[model samples]
Target: MLSVSVWPCAQADSKAQRKGRYLPEYMAHPGKMLPAIAEHAITHYTQPGDLVVDPMAGIGTTLVEAVHADRMALGVEYEPRWADLARRNVEHATDRGAPGYAVVVQGDARDIVRLVGSDTVGKAALVLTSPPYEDSLHRHVRCGHGSSLTHRNPDESFIRFREILEGCYLLLKPGGHLAMTSRPKQCGGKFCDLPSRAWQSAIDAGFELLGRYVALLSEVRDDDLVNAADVPAHLPRHEEVHILTKPANSEVVAQRVTRIAA
Candidate 1:
């Protein structure tokens, strides 16, 4: 029952005021979703004691929030450095006597079922994450061990997005939800609708789009618009989180089982 209705423009708090403040080692970055946003999504989609997952759990934002919200958490990080930080953060959150447990597995999210085990398939209540934004970031930053880099090609990025969604679809129980954070991007003088692309991929991967929430990173100002001929003209300072769900029917479950097995 956490209501996000009050945050039409999204809350603006200094990075120091957020949950990430507890762990200064993992500074807030463009690739990571805000812990506040993740907490809101988790509470809205799942009740206490449910199992929540973040396949691309950078620095354990979703995992820590899930644990604090009294839901069991599972995170998978491809970068070894981030995986290590996530593991430590999870431990830190759990040691505080949070109601639920958290664990991070290091591996490609596309191979999640294999890494986490087939037993978790159809058992998770929610899968939430903010996937890589193709080549959005200009330069890579060192995340403790090494620089964090993602696929730069849009074509490869979309393909990887679909693969991750397909894996997440299998991880959810019938009626379980999948929520992802995405923002529109400017590509070669054209605006790419990543949220829509992800939605189509999720549908093809057997998920139904349920809702969309926009989280503002900063207040957009009219003066911020420069002499640029972009589609939106002024870049949106907000990112979107798309909520999706598996059909709550035995037939859909059967189809998912058949699809995953094959």
Candidate 2:
């Protein structure tokens, strides 16, 4: 458990430069996780050779970071376009001599257990991912005092999101960790506390709440932090990272007891 609350993952570089490690087309994916965020979670939560999985892997950022850190990786993406891109990114990491191996599957994360197969069930050491902000792939508008996005029925979307979290729970080994990053957003003149919603969703999916951490996405200047968004109001300075753990199962506890007795 890291006592520090904020993770300073913001880099002193332009957005294009910061994304240089990924392919050009990957920029089109709106929900892509920051590389530093993925790297920090992987480094702190898992060891070399541990398996890391990302259920909603947009363009394989988590997978790439995990393999680069010498950990095996798995990703599941629903869209065929993004799934293909994820595979290409994994291939690119392999070509660059990343020490660990990775695989990308084209399937819905709500069915993660079946997508990754029974052999992979309960084998992952960490699950790092970000859920989509709303029902849409990208924000309808990037600027303005309030959101210009259309309000759709979020009930179905949230249901699917919870299903994905439940699947992630089943994919992890006993006592494995899950790190998810999300930010609050204004939708249709109302503030949506997405981080809190995600935290509740994890709890409902059987994960024990560990701690909430902040990952800065802005620059520090003159003892003040710059806002990363170009929006005129409700600007975002950081994303909330919620760390949680799957409770150890009876089988795992019995194994530990046996080892101690031996």
CA RMSD per model (angstroms)? 5.8, 6.2
lDDT of 2 at 104: 94
Q: How many backbone clashes does candidate 2 have?
A: 0
**Residue 238, candidate 1: alpha-carbon lDDT:** 58
Report lDDT per candidate.
0.73, 0.76
Tell how far residue 91 is off in model 1, in angstroms.
1.5
TM-score of candidate 2 versus the correct structure, residues matched by position: 0.84
Best by TM-score: 2
**Model 2, 217: alpha-carbon shift in Å?**
0.7
For model 1, what is the alpha-carbon lDDT of residue 128? 92
